[model samples]
Target: MDTKFDFGEPESQNTVYIRRVATSTLPEEIREQVPDLDSMYAVHDAEGEQLALVRDRSMAFVLARQNELSPVSVH
Candidate 1:
């Protein structure tokens, strides 16, 4: 079944580290673009992979779309 995720925060600003994930965790077509992710934030390839993640509402989605997440939810 398809699921949704909410990543949380920015790595640069936070001390907590999230779990490490493999690129395979993402969709096959965009797996290569998955960026080095931290507990607080996640980065994606510059090639719209970020946008896809956000659209899917995956954990990486939250990181890629940090601006949209509320401060309360980020924590």
Candidate 2:
């Protein structure tokens, strides 16, 4: 038997990705929340897990920063 341990940075590490998503492509339930916008920005973590959806790119970045995470553009 061998005993080996590895301690490295977490997979997520508070990093987030920001990208644009068309409102029309979202589900009807989600679409109802942003009736005034045709498109919005989506924030996701390093694991590609969505965190929040905002009406604009700036808001997406702000939201991530507010949560103490680094934001990056997906495209």
Per-residue C-alpha lDDT of model 2 across residues 49-69, encoded as one tens digit per residue: 888988899999888889888
Name model 1 segments beyond 4 Å from true.
Answer: 1-22, 35-68, 72-75
Q: TM-scores of all models?
A: 0.22, 0.79
Steric clash count of candidate 1: 2
Candidate 1 C-alpha lDDT tens digits along 1-66: 578887886544422222333455655555545454321233334221322233222564456346
- Which candidate comes out best when scored by TM-score? 2
**Ten-residue stretch with the least lDDT total in model 2:** 5-14
**How many pairs in model 2 have backbone atoms within 3 A of each other, for residues 3 or more apart or on separate chains, i.e. clashes?**
0
TM-score of 1: 0.22
Per-candidate total of colliding backbone pairs: 2, 0
Q: Candidate 2 at 19: error in angstroms? A: 0.4
